[model samples]
Target chain A: MPPDTTTVAPQSVAPSGAPASGRPADDLRTLESGLDALQAVPSTEKGSVRRILEGVLPPVLLLAGLVAVWQLYVVIARPRPDLVPGPLDVLGALGTAWADGRLQLAVLTSLERGGVGFLIAVAIGTPLGLLLAEWRPLRLALGPLLSGLQVLPSVAWVPAAIIWFGLSDATVYFVVLMGAVPSIANGLVSGIDQVPPQLRRVGTVLGAGRIQLATLVVLPAALPGYFSGLKQGWAFSWRSLMAAEIIAMGGTIGFGLGSMLQQSRELADLGSVLATILLILGVGILVELAVFAPIERRLLRRRGLTPGGIR
Target chain B: MSAAPAVLPAIRITALGKRFGADGPLVLDDVTLSIQPGEFVCLLGASGCGKSTLLNIIAGLDAPSTGTVTVASGSAAVMFQDAALFPWLTAGRNVELALKLRGVPRDKRRGKALELLDVVNLADAASKRPHELSGGMRQRVALARSLAQDRKVLLMDEPFAALDAITRDLLHEELERVWRETGRTIVFVTHNVREAARLGQRVLLMSSRPGRIANEWRLADDGPRRIESPEVSRLSIEITEQLRREIRRNAA
Candidate 1:
């Protein structure tokens, strides 16, 4: 590779006072601007309304179709109401729960636990990830174990958590941490690994010290990977919390969606159980659309990883 | 040129040698050179000629296995083949990072960054991200960031090799303008004969497999030269022939 050099030609007296170079200064500027215009990617983002419609309409239509299918199945086969509830029955059950405020309470309880547990996992995982990333020996010792933890079904931890913490918020949190921490830590490790050697070299050349390089360069570079880790961690946390809530329900633990579903199962009320399942799915979708999607889109757009502003 | 006070050489290398390990083959051997203040010197060589290693030694990124590198200014700023800008940062903020590292206060950093961007004729691109800019434009922003270091010497390692021919030509003009304006000593490493002939005031050719300076050319400061100019082409041909001979010698 040839090194690129920039130089200023010593001013020379050309006939008619024209600069003695490739082109006149004005012409060069025009050429440069023209080049930039031609090569630069144009913004391809659609209007906000269109983007929203595009995002929302398909899922909305799909959900409606799903309900229609369930209703049709009920109308055709005519299954008993208790054995397999129709879509309307599920909706009625959801309405009854909403009317009695049970739905709101269950949602709030589950969401609060999920949020707190995820935050704690992040707090713990971030430093652990950094430590593992920075220390080769430690990573060698523990990296495979961390990855293995991510694949282990978090539900498997519920019985152990219940035995250890005895049917309290501690058990729920313990399960959630076990599920989420490995994912967040793994995300950070991979993110750090992905930071280009060139960028780090650039930081060193710019006079960044060890700490500055890690904080300012390496960490920021690792963000996309770290962010994906957070998304995965949130999923794991929510899933683990639900599992723990269903299995270890008693003493200081208010009714969550998981508990409500378990109660409906015990009563053999298929409608309420179906309603609870829908609510859990809805909350997961809401968080993804409201929080993670927007952040990921912005990250990708800024890095030009998204082509034509479309992911 | 106006008469000026005597100045120390911007860079001096003494018997510099580099090898990967004790038993490894030498990458650079017995390399010695001195560059005057405000000089534009190009290290021209083939792929494995250790020109980049020699540069790394001067930039202090790599230690010499033997001998010494004395840079008068105590610091040098470097640019690479890729712009190597932080992707998360806008072009201006990328430059500002260098200024910030130099301890420029937050209040003053933006203004200084913009000033350097203006030097590279990229002031309008300050807010654009590196990926959003064209290859040529990205390199210009990189130039701005290097300039933001406020160092007396700028080391470039094939900064425009990835650009198109027309863009590379334009950047050559831009770089010449900057070098003249900033009066900074520059050590540019390149494998391209014409690029060396077109840019550097002095061109030093390095031989590969225990790289050593094989020959040198001091191009006369004739009125603005272009890559296509007869003088540059003639010199490039001469240098290319010498470079080929050096390669053949290694084979023999």
Candidate 2:
């Protein structure tokens, strides 16, 4: 990668004309200047520790304030410990669960089920959505059903799923599939619908076959929508798995967060119940931050579509 | 290569007509023209003229309502007014997609894309996405992508219309150089009289409202034509006057 400065010459690549003829070799000059004007300088904005601190501080302070308020309410109300656990009691219960490794086991079990179920939903939903998008008659027939399924809460599927499969992993998976597939499929459909007509024409004129157009052009163009669908699908899958665990009890299925929540309720361990609720909320928040947010930010940044980048 | 057979017309439009729906008005009616190999022909008309429609049909993006259109050699590639470079792809990747579709080997595509970008004087910008580039740069990438198709005919639909005057002038020179180098048959559609005069060896003027070929001019002169040249300005003025008359006739 050495510069090889000794061999370099300062000559223009554009064709030169005789000075007497007077075309003046301005074409190359014009091109060079025009490019100099058009080529954007790469962004130099740096993410310093100060900026990171600024971003994190508000959320941290808000959570602390909420906890303080909750503790104050408990102190004033002085409810019986068994009836309503204070924040400290819930934390103590969480610490004990963590020490015994029950908390870890429940978290792992629930996350594994949610991950597998959401992946399956994506596998089925993406192509279904693409098919629905491309074919007019199919979209007309089935589009409304997909939207309706999204509106129906994931909990509603638990009874039907239990009846179909009889308190097994199959029942849990069925519930997850019913809950998630519609959202992913519908997101993809809307994504496909939003594809600019000009881009499609560009694909056609570039000699892409129908399949090529769909896979290469339309699919990549729809990434934003697909990612949004994936996020929603994950949310639904988690909700559906919890619903299945809560309703279809005494299963041979492993201990999950939902079952733990139900057990704590039945035993009337209010502190454990609060701890379980926190764990569920924590897992959802963790996935949103670690998995979805970074990918979405990168996608938008690469396209220069971030609102901050516009001006 | 020197012994290669005589070159044929690159594009032929015969008795072509186009309409939208069954009840829609005719957009183009009985238009016929032949463009020679390596020729630069400009299609010029007013706003409602079906010049863009004709280019679309020539590019095979839309079908003619009647009659036949033939391309003499390889397929025609088109450059639209907007750059239409996929926002998801980098500049080099945008050009490489066309090459990929044309069945270029995967390993060769990257180098070939860089080379094409160099032809448009954008080798340094290969990694930039469409949005990172300004209007002119994006259009340059679009042009490179069209060239990667390696077609005999290049159909441009007002490709420079969206650019500012300075950028448009620069592009005119760049395009002229490319046409000279590649010897591709170019049918450039534009409403700009000076642009048509500067670039085209022949200009075909069409009348609007059931667009039809109303006049033709052949600039078989001896030298390179610049847009600001007296000769080019004179020709543009002549064409503009005739174009105005056609519009008035339609209005009347």
Candidate 3:
């Protein structure tokens, strides 16, 4: 059994041996500062030059090796120039296209279509994703359908779009939307799903209303996933546009990289065909590195999600 | 300090009870209590005693199945065990978010946030992200954020339970100082007997199995207290014995 009295009488106002007021506070300050300094996260960021080299070197080396192999095959096989063009022939084709400004025009035309299509996809997909995420019954009904649409090749839509729109810009845009919208919407859905329940509770405790919660807490938290989705959406839009341009050629359609490749094929210009493929691949790689890569790196770095020594 | 006779209780609960689902087991039963303004009370119990459930009810995060809880101040702020700081915001901005939600003007928020961070002795760590700060610093930033809510009542659910002993001890001092400085009504829930005896003016021990308030102790002395002090240890030992008895009774 314990003592009957619940209250303990005051023994003393201040203990005889206790540390003085200002001293303990100062000591605590020192101790805490020491702990903070000791446990601080070490900056592992490499120099700018080193980081660039690390990112760019491996791909460059791989491309060089591929070119070497192509030259060796040309030397050994001795095939017809029009059938399997050598690396130099492809370079010459690129040079001719550049000198005549055809390369620039083709690249710009394709890029403009891709950019407009992706912007439209963002406008459509963001709301659709937010709606799907918010309404449970809608999500249950449409979630699987969205995922299925993402897997269905946007290229498969080319013939239907051509039949519907009759070889115009509208046909290209329809194909691009069909390809990009699902991925963007699905990305947002998963991002919203992955937000920690704890964060929602925090927002509520801090007096966030429904709109405030969605705009401030939920949307920002969903950004990383949404961004990746946008990247994938852009890729799909570009691919779908290329497919539309290649198949639905002639009749008020501007010539793009895809049409250029098709033209080279018709003329038996294998070198130009290979050159156009290289140009397409180059555009994809350039967008990924110049636009998407830097943004993703900054996002992950701000959240401390990146592993050490990689920045 | 004692509340004036004319002042109302900071919090009043009447016949509070809670259960999860339609046929779910009762988690809390008949938990009626009143806390005076500026009183520092500890809700001490074993794990699964539904202490957290009672706190949630008072905080208005969970609804009580069979009673009403009234807070005279009309609002309360809570500090959770995990700190729960957003990783994207810096420590200062985390506090500023609460202020912004409270309708503070944009131009004034930064100054107020820095002031709150200063209250927790974290003025210099305002720009550091949650991930950059140590565990103790994160909790301090959380404390600063909760304080920025500027409510008269503060509810804490084992806020220091996850931290190391040395840090927990230091935080106890910081909390006591803050409590004294701000004079807010605090209802702190914890399983640690010594922690209760050290920080609380009154310790309410709750029993398990449809949790109810089983015993209470009042330590009326006004002075600095240490967890390892003989007085604290003596009271902790007494509470532990009563707690063991409650457990044994539940087992039967």
Candidate 4:
């Protein structure tokens, strides 16, 4: 096709006082600012209070709605206290646990176990993912198997883990690793696969060695996928730890949120059961908010992938 | 340009041929060409002409199926039709990466990258990510990144093909200015006849399906040539006619 050389004059977009190419300095400055203004994103200048409210209000309303529904069900059905617990009953149980410091202790133990398990998963999975991504024969043989493992729920691994490691922390860790490694590895592989060929070409042409290219170019490109994998891995770790704690039935392992849940269920203390479930949910959300969300937001915002970008 | 110091041409290709596989038809065949040092050469051809393939071989990014390409400078940088700037990187950091690869020290890279960005009229945009920049601005950053290589030869495969007409025009002027300033040998592959007429000191028109150089135009005038100039328009027409004839022959 004949290249269209004439479409519209650039003069409209050119900066005011843009020179007609005689003075080099003037022309450059005009072009620079003009280009900037042309591509400028709208200022994300919402008031801080408004921004906070926008972020927090919906979730708060959703929680309130959920509590209202729970309360309504309690009032309507008049379920025995031994069965479904009302929101206030659950809250009272939570407050009692908090006063005794068991709530904090249980949460910390679960979080620590989840954190350690996830770290181990990352340490193992990252290299495995890189290897699978780079080596065709190995990938072809094992890629499908890894993906299959990811789909299999962490609870399924608990029986095997208990048999192998007994009623110890190792059993919990084993289950967590089994649940998480595949996900993290798969994430890395997909990310590596998606690194655009042109970007690699650009890196090669720019004189980056294979190691440098992989580290500087490919790794950064794959960050979104890696971060996603990490998030999923954390979820897996948390789920696996809970399953192990609930099933193992050992007193020495200490009271994690999962152990507390089992104790509440056995005693028919539905209020404590509901409170334990809420605590588990709350901890998961807290970790996501404090650890993962900020990093993800920063990554996306800096790359201009976020809605408003860094504001 | 800089007083032609060396006898060697910037690029030399001899009896070049390319095929996808053993049984595949030849994409390029028996192409021989020489590009002088500090010259602006445009390879102008239609779709399936192997212009990009030829450029790739010269760039050391792809191996030719037959014959050879020898670049005197050894090092060359390429700019693609897409800006292909690392979206994860800021505009300056993209250029800085090129400089860093070339072994520019920690402190020097930032200064050098800023200078290169300035040349592309993007100094103020150094901290902006690729996704934040307009297509034109992204391309200018890509250009700056290419320039950061400090290489004597640049291979561009339709670098401005995706830009709007006005942006392309403005870039053409900026590119011409940079070319004049740097004195680097440039091989720009484009389907645009007017673009070839406007920028290239010499234009090579290639035929497709076993691509070969069919015609050549050397702009003899010493005066500056704009894309809209009568001389450029006349040359563009001449070349377009020749290209049309090549396409028609294929149709027949």
lDDT of each: 0.88, 0.85, 0.88, 0.86
TM-score of each: 0.94, 0.90, 0.93, 0.93
lDDT of 1 by residue, A1-311 (tens): 22121211111111222245546566666767877888887877688899888778887899889888989999999998999999889999999999999999999999999999999999999999999999999999999999999999999998887788887899999999999999999999999999999999999999999999998999999999999999999999999989988988878888999999998899899999999999999999999888888999888778878733332
Q: Which candidate achieves the best DockQ against the true structure?
A: 4
Question: For model 1, how does the per-residue alpha-carbon lDDT over B36-57 read when each residue is reduced to its tens digit?
Answer: 9999999999989999999988
DockQ of each: 0.42, 0.33, 0.40, 0.45
Candidate that beats the other on lDDT, 2 or 4, i.e. the better one: 4
Candidate 3, residue A181: lDDT:
99
Q: Provide the lowest-lDDT 10-residue window in model 1 chain A.
A: A5-14
Counting only residues 3 or more apart in sequence or on different chains, how many pairs clash (N, Cα, C under 3 Å) in candidate 2?
0
After superposing candidate 2 on the true structure, give the runs of residues whose Cα lies further than 4 Å from its correct spot.
A1-31, A38-45, A48-54, A73-84, A307-311, B1-7
Which digits, one per residue and each the tens of the lDDT, describe model 3 over residues A201-292?
Answer: 88999999999999889998898889889989999998998888898899878889999989998998999999999999999988987898
lDDT of 4 by residue, A106-188 (tens): 99999898899999999999999999998999999999999999999888888887777777888888889999999999999
Tens digit of lDDT per residue, candidate 4, span B68-158?
8999888798999999999888899999999999999999999999999989888988998888788889999999999999899999999
How far in Å is the alpha carbon of A292 misplaced in model 4?
0.8
What candidate 1 gets wrong by more than 4 Å, as runs, is: A1-27, A307-311, B1-6
Which ten residues in a row are the worst by lDDT in model 2 chain B?
Answer: B221-230
Task: Please list, in the order the candidates appear, how each scores on TM-score for chain B only.
Answer: 0.97, 0.96, 0.97, 0.96
